[model samples]
Each structure stands twice: as structure tokens, then as C-alpha cells.
Target: MRLFIAIELPDGLKRAFAGLRTPIPGARWVPPEQIHLTLAFLGEVEETAVGHLHDELSRIRIPSFKLRPAGTGCFPGRQRARVLWVGLEPEPHLRDLAAAVQSVLLACGIPQEERPFSPHITLARLKLPAPREVGLFLSGEPKHAFPLVPVREFILFQSRLSSAGAQHVPLHSFPLT
Candidate 1:
């Protein structure tokens, strides 16, 4: 099964992002329901391993923290961009939560990512759209400063790729105290 661990966004934020998607011409916007801040992407794992992964997740202890979506940015240096995302503030607690989740994946024999983690909620994937337009859109600041919201849970999601886009299913959820 294809899986990953992430922090789901609240409904209001999802709606806000959805509104942004309506106008973008060629970019493939992820379904609002699938919008999440992925901490780690565990590409494929044996179905049987899910149980053990859940156990490791259950043992994770992290205190809830507020998350503020600060800015807009793109990945791969924006020269040949692939992903458009909303940048997150450097919240120590959020980083700690991500680290805890990473530890669980490592303990489960999952390979660790060598790249340093940069927390962001992917808004869209650049495909047919002119990358230049994305730069123009990002040239101006976002109208609002989404206030910090408390994050209390991390979810294990299964990604199903389709013609439309990737559909995510929640396999399990673990609460942070």
C-alpha cells in the first residue's frame, strides 16, 4: 500500500485554497479534501506493515502547537517548478512533531529522507500551466495571514493515483496531547 503521515488542514483553510484553485488555468489543484501538510511520504509499504506502523505512531508523544501559513512559494527553485505551496512559519513545535513522526518511520525500517524538511501545504502541481503565471501570482502577497491554528492530530494516509489526481484516504489518526 502507498502511505504517508501528514497533518490535515481544517475545513476553513481547505475552502480558502479551493477558492484559489478556481481561477488557475492549467495547474492541477489537489482536491480540497486531500489537502494536508505531509510530514513524510512513505511511497509504498506492505499491507501487513500498516499494523506495526500504527503501533509506532500510537507511541508518539507530541504537544499540540499552532501553525501559521505565512507565505506562498514553489519547489525545485522555481526555475522549473513542479509544486506550488504555501510556506509555513518556523514553528519549533511543528518541527518537533515532524521529527517524532520521522522517528517512527525510521524505526519501522523506512528509509529516511536526506533532504531537510521544509513544512508546507501543497496547493497545486504545475503541469500544463505556464510557470510564469505562478510567479506573477506569487509576486503579490496573499490577502490574508491565516492565523495560527492548533494541530492536535497526525494522520496516516493512503494515496490512490487517478486520472483526475491523487486521492487520499485516512488509514489511521493519532492524537497529540
Candidate 2:
């Protein structure tokens, strides 16, 4: 199964981001329901190994913390932006939690993510190289500061890709104490 671990966004925050979707040509906006802060992406794991993964993840212990969206940016740098996203304020606890998740998954024989952990919610996928308008939008000061929301739990999700875009199914949730 195609799997990943992420923290689900609160309803209020989801609604707030939903309103930020402007009509940018050649960009595909992510649906609010699918918005999440991913900790790790484990691609194509065997069914039998899922049980081990679940067991290890259930033992994760971290204190709950609050997070808020800060500014807008894109992947592969602003000049060659491909994925538009909203940046999250750097929280040490958040990074710790993500590291713990990666450690456990690695012990379970899953390949580690080569890229450094960058916490952001993908807003849209640009079809062509990012246009001047996208740069302009991000250049402005953040129009909104998302309300701080509690992070009480993280979930393991199964991703099924289709023509309609990826469908994320929550398989299990791990609570933060």
C-alpha cells in the first residue's frame, strides 16, 4: 500500500485555506478535505509489513502543541516553483515528532526520506513553471495569519491515485499525550 503519516488540519483552518485558492492558470488546487501536514511518506509497502508499522507507530509519545500557517511559498525555489504551499512556523517539538516518526519507520525497514523535513501544506500543483503572477502573490505579505490549532494526534493514511487526484484514507491515528 502507498502510505504516509500526517497531522490532519482542524475544520476551521481547512476552511480558511479553502478561501485562499485563487484562480491561477495551470495550477491545480488541493481540495480542503485532503489538506494535511505530512511527517513521512512511505511509498509502496507490503501488506504484511503494515502490522509492524502500526505497532511501532502506536508507541510514539509526544506532547501536544499548537501550530499556525505563516507565509506562502513554493517547491524547487521561487524561480522554478512547482508546488505552491503555505509555510508553518518552525516549532522544535514539531520537528522532534517528525524525526521520531522517521526513526520508527526506518527501523521497520522502510526507506528514509532523503529530503530534509519541511513542514508545509501543499496548496496547489503548477502545470508549467511558476508564472510571474504566482511570484507576485507570494511576494506580498501574508494576507492572513491562520489561527493556532492544537496538534493532538497524527494519522497514517493510504493514498490511492486516480484521475481525480490522490485520495487519502486514514488507516490509523496515533495520539500525542
Candidate 3:
């Protein structure tokens, strides 16, 4: 089964995310319901090991915190962009939470992600040669600041891939207290 751990956004806030979408050729916009800040992406895992993953994750006890979308940018490099995203304000506690989650995954014998954690909400998937405006779009600050939202919990999501796009389903939830 394909799995990942992430902080899902509230319904109203997700609608606000949808409001930011713009028409860009070859760019695929993510549905508002699928918008989330991923903490860890555990590619594909055996069905039997999922139980251990859940057990270890439940032990995590971090205080809930808030986050806000700050600006827009593209992944890899704007010169060769593939994924467009909205950056979040720097929050030490958010980083701590991600680290704790990663630590547990490692203890559970799951291999660590090669890339360091950089939290952001992906807005679109771009196909190269990406439109020239992708770089231009990210050049300035966002016209307005998105409201702050609480992060009371995170969920272990199962990603179902299909011809259309990936659909995420929450399998288990871990609360912060």
C-alpha cells in the first residue's frame, strides 16, 4: 500500500486555497480537498508493516500550532520548474513535529526521505517546458496573506493512483495534545 503522513487543511481554508488558482497551460491544479502540507511521504509499504507504523505514530505528543501561507514559488528551480507551491511561514514547532514523525518512522525501520523537510502547499503540477509565466508568477509576494489555521492532528494517508490523478484517503489519524 502507498502511504504518507500529512496535516490536512480545514474545508473553508481549502476553499480559500482554491481561490488562488490561475490558468496556466499544462499545469494541473490540485483539488481543494486534496490540498495538504505533507510531513512525510512513505512511497509504497507492505500491508503487514502498517500496524507498526500506526503504533509508533500514536506515541507522538506535540502541542497543536498554527500556520499561514506566505508566498508562492516553484520546486527544483524557477528556471526548470515542475511543481508550483505556496510557501508557509517559518514555524519551529512545525519542524519539530516533522522531525519527531521522521524519527518514529526510522525507528519503525522505514527508510528516511532523502530530501530535507520543507513545508509548503502544492498548488499545481507543471509540465516542461513550463510556461514563462510560472517564473513571473512567483516573482512577487502574494497579493494577500492567507489566514492562519490550527494544526490539531495529522493523518496517515493512502494514495490511490489512477489515470486522472492521485486521490488521498485517510486511514488513521493521530491527534496533537
**Best by TM-score, which number?**
2
Q: Residues 11-130, candidate 2: write the lDDT tens digits.
A: 778878878876677888889999889899999999899999999999989999999789988888776778989889998889989999999988999998899999999988888875
lDDT of each: 0.83, 0.88, 0.88
At residue 177, what lDDT does model 2 achieve? 90
* CA RMSD per model (angstroms): 1.8, 1.2, 1.4
**lDDT tens digits, residue span 23-134, model 3:** 6778888999899999999989999999999999999989999998899888988777889888899988899899999999999888888999999999888887465778
lDDT of 1 by residue, 74-131 (tens): 8885556778888888899889888988898889998878998899988888765466
Candidate 3 clash pair list = none
TM-score of 3: 0.94
lDDT of 3 at 58: 96
lDDT order of candidates, top first: 2, 3, 1
Give the TM-score of each candidate. 0.91, 0.95, 0.94
Worst 10 residues of 2 by lDDT: 133-142
User: What is the alpha-carbon lDDT for the whole of candidate 3?
Assistant: 0.88
> What is the Cα-based lDDT of residue 24 in candidate 3?
71
